[model samples]
Each structure stands twice: as structure tokens, then as C-alpha cells.
Target: MKLFLVTKVVPFIMQLFVRFIYISSKKVFHHPKIDSKEPFIVAFWHGELLMQPFNYKRIRPKGKVSAMISEHKDGEAITRTVEYLGIDSIRGSSTRGGAKALIGAIKELKAGYDIAITPDGPKGPRHSVADGIVAISQKTNARILIFNCRPTKYWQFNSWDKFIVPKPFGKLEFFIQEPLDISSLEQKEAKELIQDKMLLNAMK
Candidate 1:
């Protein structure tokens, strides 16, 4: 009974929180070369997950976009939020079921679904990229695009990732880095290169 109440009531409250975020985040997308319809992987830090979904919803790609979520309680909450926004979720992480998740992402990409991943997510060393994204990109020949969201006013959590919650009606800056092609590089090299690019772009 307790579990049932928590699941139903907690998500209802979270849905309100998500609505507040959607209304507050004013997104400015910086995609000069890539069109919204193009199939590519969007990599962002987990801290910005709250607002990233709003940005993706605005973009409205013709294909589905899948996000990786860990199989944890918090991840269950996140999966609910993602589903609310009409985006698909794949449950896994670097430590558990990581390989399976990567393969799933690859298949999603091959089926023409644009994928989004919070590289430093589910549990993080804070802004670090795992090899799964790189592997999926290389296997699927998808371009990886680094994205970050900067909010004008927000509260930062004390958590590992310092998760941000934007104040209602605050402006958000969405930065999209140039796409990195993984077609030529080997898996090891591609992973390092993508990680470096994400780190560098996330700074601004």
C-alpha cells in the first residue's frame, strides 16, 4: 500500500515540477549546420536533464529519441518524466547492463531514432563520459553532438551532479557543439575524443 501510494502521488507532484520547468526554461538552440530532422546523438550532462527534455520537445524530430536511464529508484522517476514528454527510455548504466544498453541504443539509431544521453549520469563523477556512447556512435555511424543548458536563475542541489532547478520564467541557454563523426576513428580513440569534446563544450 505504501509503495503504491508513493508511486502514484510522488509522480503526480513531479509532473507539476516538470510543468514548472517547462514554463521557466527559455531555450535558445544553437544548431547552425544540423537540421532538426537529422539523426544524431545529443550528449548532455545529467545535471541539465530537467530542461533538456523541453529542448528536445521543441526540436520535434521526425524520429523517436531515446534516453538512457539507470535501473534505480531515481531512474524510475526520471523515466516517468521522460515518458511524460513522449520520449522513450532505455534502462541501464555503465556498471550494470551497460553493454546491453549500448546495443539497444545502436539498434535505435539504426532504426533512425535520434538518441540523447547524459554521459555523466545515473551516478556520476560529475561531467564524465563513459565509453558506451562512443561505442554506439561508432557502431551506428551516428554523429555525436555535445549540448549543455545554462539557466539564468536556479537552485543547485547538494548531490554529486549539483542538479539545477530553474526558477519559473528563467532564461535557458542551449549550446550545441559541432557534430563529431565517429566513422573514421577506432572505438578507443573515438571514446577519448568524444569525452574531451563533451568536457570542453560543457565548460561554456
Candidate 2:
């Protein structure tokens, strides 16, 4: 019942509200690289989800983009929300069906879809990066770009990552770091580097 409500019913209402609110008041400041066409992996902390999708849709290349979502009740809502934004979603998490999720992500990347992941998502230790993102990048030979969203006005959920919801008509700042190429690095080294980059980019 909970999943049904979140996946089917709640999204219709939330989508309407979020679209109206986001469209009414949202300003984005971006520093995107000129060569953004190449397929790459996008990494962002989970807390900044609200505004990240909007910004990504603005700058992401004209290709299929997929986001990794947890197979939990909350993920149902997120799946719907992402779909409304016209981005595809793959349901799996580090805790459940992780291997399959990673394989699917790699296949998507290979198929030319830029992938998006939340290193500290599905339940997080708040800003911590998991190894899955790094593994996917290494396996797929995809470059990783770390992105973040800073809101001038928003509500902070008392969750592990302090999830933020930008208020309508508010200003949002998007920070895009240089892409980290993982094709050459060892798995352990790549994970460390990506984790550090994700943390640095997410900090205020």
C-alpha cells in the first residue's frame, strides 16, 4: 500500500507542486565545461537531490541519463519524480541487488547514457561516498563529474544527509568539478579519489 501510494498517487500531486514551485522561482549559476558532450558519470550527494535534477536536465548532454535508486519505499517516490523529469531510473541499492544495479549502470553507460549516482544515498552516513560509484566508473571506463546544488533558501529534512528542499523562486548555485577519469586508476585508488571529490564538492 505504501509503495503504491508513493509510486502512483503521491507523485502526481508532488510533481504538480514541485514543478509549479521550481518553475516559479529558480535561478541557476553554472560553470559547466565547454566539452560536456562526452558521456560521463555524474556524482552528487543525496541531500541535494531536490535541485540537482533540474540543473542536470539543463546541462546534461542530449542522451539518455539514468539515476540509481534504492528499492525502498522512499525510492518509489523518487522514481516517479525522476520519471516526470524525463530521466530514466534503475532501482537497486548498495544494500539490495547492488551487483545487478552496478552491472545495469555499466551497460547503460556503455550504451551511451550518462549515469547519475548518489554516493551517500538510499540511507547514508551523511556525505560519505560508497565504492559503487567508483566501481561503475572503472568498469565502464567512464569519466566522473561531481556536481552539487547550493540553495539560498530551503528546508532541511532531519534525515541522515539533511535533505534540502529549495523554496519557490529561490536562487540555486550549481558547482561542477572537473571530470575524474577512472579508466586508469586501480579500484581502491579510484574509490578514494572519487569519495574525496564528492565530499569536497558537497561542502558549503
Candidate 3:
């Protein structure tokens, strides 16, 4: 019953929540490489995912955006949220059915849809980059576009990922860093760089 309610209702609630964010907070985008409409890997920490479902329409309004979501109950709920909001989701997680997810992401990218990733998700140490994003970028030869959001006042959950929810009405600022090519960097280095760009200050 709980799963059914969550899967059915949360999507609508989340849509309203996203709208509240849009109306309550200020938004800004800094995409330096707008000349190229090439598909890239979009990443952010899992905690900051609350209002991300609105980002595609806010940033690339007409471009295709698909996310790599975990294959779990929570993921299923989130998949519904994204789908309801008009973003596509491919379900799989690092610990479960990951290989299939990677292939799906690659195919999506190849077909011109940008792939969104929570590098340290499906369980996280918070703000760390997992191996999946790096591996997917290297395999598909797609650049990783890391982004971040800092809200003036918000709710921070005590979950493993330190999940955050910005207060209904607050100042929210988003930063989009320039795309970083993973095909050129070693796996470990690529992961570190992606983590640093997402966690540390990459762009203001």
C-alpha cells in the first residue's frame, strides 16, 4: 500500500514541489558551450536532487534528457516523478542490474539524449563520485557536465545520502560547469575530477 501510494502520489506532489521551487527561488544557468548541442553526461550529488526534475526544462528546454535511476522501490518512485515531469528514466543501480543500465545509458547518449547521473547514489558517502559515471563516459566517449545547487535555507535529511529539500521559499542558485572529457583521463583521475567539480567550487 505504501509503495503503491508513493509511486502514484509522490510524482504529482514532486511536480508541485518543483513548481514551488521555480516560483519561490531565483534560478540561473551558466552553460558556456551552448554552441554545441551535443549530448553529455549530467551529474550532481544525490542529496541535491529535489528540484532537478525541473532542470531539463529550465536549462535545455527543447533537448532530450534521460536519467539513469536505481532499480529499487525508491528509484521506482523517482522514476515516476521524472516521467511525470517529462524526463525519461532508465532503472538500474551499481549493486543491482548495473551492466544493463550502463548499456542503456550508452544507447541513450548515442541516440542524442543527454544522460543524467547521481554519481554517488544507490547509497552514497555523500558528494563522492561512483565508478559508473566515469565508466559510462569513457565507454561512450561523452563529456561529463557536472552541476551544483546551493539553497539559502533548506531541509537536510539524515539519510545515508544526506538528502536535501530546499525550503518552499528560499534563494536557490545553480551552477553548470564546462564539460569535462573522460576519454582522455584515467579512470581514477576522472572519478576524482568529477567529484571535485561537483563538490568543490567549479563555477559560480
Candidate 4:
């Protein structure tokens, strides 16, 4: 029963809720032009995750996108939710199935999919960068693109990442930072670079 609710009921409700909010909100994206043809490792904070599928579709609908989702129970729901929006999921995270996840992500990027990741996820030091994201870039030679979203009015959860839910008819602002090439950098340096860029571009 719990599995049915988590995998089926939750996603069904979430898709309706997300779509309603997105349709009612005023979305504003701030970014320079980017090539749709080039693949990127799209990184965003877990707290800012709810609206990303909509944001990604609005910004780069033509690009094939897939995300590395954790194997946590909640992750299953999220994977189903995003699939409704046409985004693919590669199951795993920093804690569980990390090796296989990284390998899958690298393969996806090489195969021309924009691999999305919430670097501080599956459990968090909330909003902090993890080494695995950098390692994926190092192994795949993929550039990392930071995507951040902030809403004018929202509910903030007491969760570790201070998760947010945008209220209806609110303004949703998105920022897409310049992509960074970390393919040759040391893991520590690359992690810091991505973290700094993410912090600098954070909308709120």
C-alpha cells in the first residue's frame, strides 16, 4: 500500500500540483544564449528542485535531459514525477549505488543527454557540493551548468535543505549561469568551483 502510494499516488498528485503552479506563475529566465546542440551536466540544489523539469523544458526543450535520482524511497516518487514531464532518471546517489550512478551519468552525457544532478542530495549537508559531481565531469569531459530558481512568494519547509514550494500566481525566476569546464581540474578544485558558481548564482 505504501509502495503504491509512493510510486503511483504521490507522483500523480505532484504532477497535477506542479503543472497547476507552473501554469499560474509568471516565469522569468535570466541567461545568455546557449547552444542547444552541446550537452551539459546540469546542476541545481536539491532545495530548488520542484520546478526544474518545467524550467528545463522552457529553456532547452529540444535537448535530451536525464537526472541521477537517489534510490531513497522519496527518490522513487520524484523519479516518477519528473518522468511525467518527459525527463529520464538514472537511479542512485552519493550514498547508495554511487558507482553505478556515476557510470550511467557519464554514459548518458556521452550519448548526448544533458545529465542533471542535485549535488547535495539523497541526504544533505544542504546546499553543499559533493565530489561525485565533479568526478563525473572529470570522467566524462562534460561541462557543468548551474541552474537556480527563486520564487517571489512561497512556502519554505523545515527540511534540511529548506525546501520550497512556490505559491500560485507567484513569480518564478530562473538563472542559468555560464557552464564551467572541469574536465581537467583536480576533484577538490572542481567541486569548489561548482559550489562557488552555484552560490554566486543562487537567486535567493
Candidate 5:
């Protein structure tokens, strides 16, 4: 029963819920000038993951999008959910299957797909940026696009990242910063810049 719910039932329900909330709400965007054809290493905090598929659609409707998801059970539900929403899921994370995931993400970006990564995810030191994403950006020579959102009304979970889901029928603001090219910087310097940008746009 639990397996069935995680693999099938949860994703189905969550998809319906996400669609209703997003369709009913007013969306506002603060986007930079974007080139629809270039791939990006799209970074956002883990807590803000819920609305990103739709957000990505608005920003780059024709661009392909993929996300790195952990191989855990909770991630199973999320994987199915995002796939349902038209984004591909690369199964791995920092603690498990890290190498394979990194390679997969690099390939995706080189193939012209925008790969979304949660700088802090699959468990946390909550909002801290991880080096894996920066390394991927460097290896693929793709710029990191920082994205985040805030909803006028919501529920905040007591998880490590204080995960939030916007209440139905509210306003949602999607924020996007200009892409950061870290290929020329030292790894430490690049990681710090990504962290600073993520922290600056973090939802309240």
C-alpha cells in the first residue's frame, strides 16, 4: 500500500493540487533577458521546488528542463510528480549516486536542456549551496540561473528546509536573477557567489 501510494497515488493527487493552485493564482515574474535556446544550470532553494516546473514553463516554455532528484522514497513521489508536469528527473543526489547524477546533469546541459538543481537538498543544512552544482556549471560551461518564488499565502512545513506550498487562490511571484558564469572563478569563489545569490533571493 505504501509503495503504491508513493509511486502512483501521491503524484497523481499532488499534480492535481499543483495545477489548481497555479492556474487559480496570479503569477508575477521578475525575469532577466533570456535566450530561449541556451541551456542553463537553473538553481533554486529546495523549499521552493514545488512551483518551479510551471515557473520554468513561463520562463522558457520551449526549453527542455530536467531536475536532479534523490533516489529515496519521498523522491520517488517527487520524481513522478515533476515528470507528470513535463520535466525529466535524473535520479541521484550529493549523498548517494552523486557521480552518476553529476555526469547526467552535465550531459543534459550540453545537450541543451536546462537542468534545475536545489543548491541545498535531499536533506539539509537548509539553504546552503553545495559544491556539486557549481562543479556541474564549471564542467559544462553553463551559467547558473538563480530562481525563486514567494506566495502571498501558504503552509510552512517543519522540515529542515521549512518546505512551503502556496494556498489555493493566492498571488505567486517568480524571481529570476541574471545568470552567473562561474567558469573562470576558483571553485570556492564560485560556490560562495552561488550561495550569496541564492540567499539573497530566498523566499520569506
Candidate 6:
């Protein structure tokens, strides 16, 4: 009964919270390509996860979006939370079933589904990028669109990733970096640059 409530009821509450975020947000979208029908990867950090599903809906309401979630209990709850916003989640993470996550993302990308990944997520050293995301981008040949969202007014949780929740009627400065072609950069270089950029923006 407790587990059921956590999975079902908690996600319901979270969906409501996300709804509040959407309606209250003062949004600025930087990339015109995102407004198009072409599918791309949105590499976002774990801390700013609350806004991603809504971001997808706001940008291209009908475009398919998918992302990897963990196989853990907390992940199960979050998977449900995101599903409420109409995004599908696959169970896997870098520490567990990482390969499965990559395979799933690749399949979705090939099918032309826009995918998002929190490189420092599901547990984090905060703003760090795991190589799996880089691999997925390389395999899919999808340009990576980096997300840099900074809450102008918000609450920061005492979580490992210092999770953020924007205050009601507050603005969030969301800057989408120019799309990066993974084929042009070495794997390590690409991951490092992404991690650096995300960390820099989060600290801003």
C-alpha cells in the first residue's frame, strides 16, 4: 500500500507541481531548430529535471520524447512522474544497466523520437557527464542541444544535486546552447565541454 501510494499518489502530486511550473514560467526559447519537427538530443543536468517534460511540450507538443531512468525504486517513482506529462521512460542508468539504456536510446533515436538525458542524474557528483550520453549521441548521429536553466527565483533543496524548484510567478533563464556535432569533436572532449558548460551555467 505504501509503495503504491509512492508510485501513484506522489507522481500525481508531482504532475500538479509540474503543471504549476508550466503555467507560471516566463519562457525564452533560444533555438529555432527545437521549434522544428526534427528530432535532437537535449542534454540537461539532473538538478533542473522538473522543467524538462514541460519544456518539450511547450516547444513541440506532438514530438515524441523519451529518456533513460534508473531501475531503482526512486527512479520508478520519477518514471511515473514524467509519464504523467506524456514522455516515456526506459529503466537503466550508468551504474546499472547502462548498456541497456544506450540501446534503448539508440532505438528511440532511430525511430525519430527526441530524447533527453541527465548526464549527472539518477545520483550525481553534480554537473558531471557520463560517457554513455556521448556514446548515444555518436551512435545516433544526433546533434546535442545543451540546456542551461537558471532559476531567477527559486528554492534549492538539500539534495545531492541541489535540486531546484522555481518560486511561483518567478522567471527562469533558460538558455539552449548551440547544437554540437559529436562527429566533429573527440569523445572525451565533447563530454568534458558539455559538463563544463552545464556546470558553468548552473553556477550562474
Number of colliding residue pairs in model 2: 1
Best-fitting candidate, scored by TM-score: 5
Evaluated at residue 96, the lDDT of candidate 6 is 89
Clashes of each: 0, 1, 0, 0, 0, 0
Candidate 1 — what's its lDDT? 0.76
Candidate 4: C-alpha RMSD after superposition? 1.2
lDDT of 4 at 163: 91
lDDT of 3 by residue, 92-170 (tens): 8787789999999999999988989998888887777788998889888889877777777778887888787788667
Determine the backbone clash count of candidate 5: 0
Backbone clashes in model 2, listed as residue pairs = 25-169
Model 5 ranges with Cα > 4 A deviation? none
| TM-scores for all predictions | 0.87, 0.90, 0.92, 0.96, 0.97, 0.92
lDDT of 6: 0.80
lDDT leader: 5
Residue 51, model 6: lDDT of 79
How accurate locally, in lDDT, is each candidate?
0.76, 0.79, 0.79, 0.87, 0.89, 0.80
Question: Comparing 2 and 5 by lDDT, which wins?
Answer: 5
**Per-residue lDDT of model 6, residues 1-204, tens digit only:** 989898999999989987897678787655445537566888888888887776666567788888788887778878999999898987899988888888989998898888888999778888788888889888888887777667678889899988888876777676677677776789889988878766756732
Model 1 clash tally, residue pairs: 0
The 10-residue segment of model 2 with minimum total lDDT is 28-37
Once fitted onto the true fold, the runs of candidate 3 whose alpha carbons sit more than 4 angstroms away are: 1-3, 202-204
lDDT of 5 by residue, 121-164 (tens): 98988988778998898898899889888999999999999999
Residue 26 of candidate 4: its Cα lDDT?
A: 95
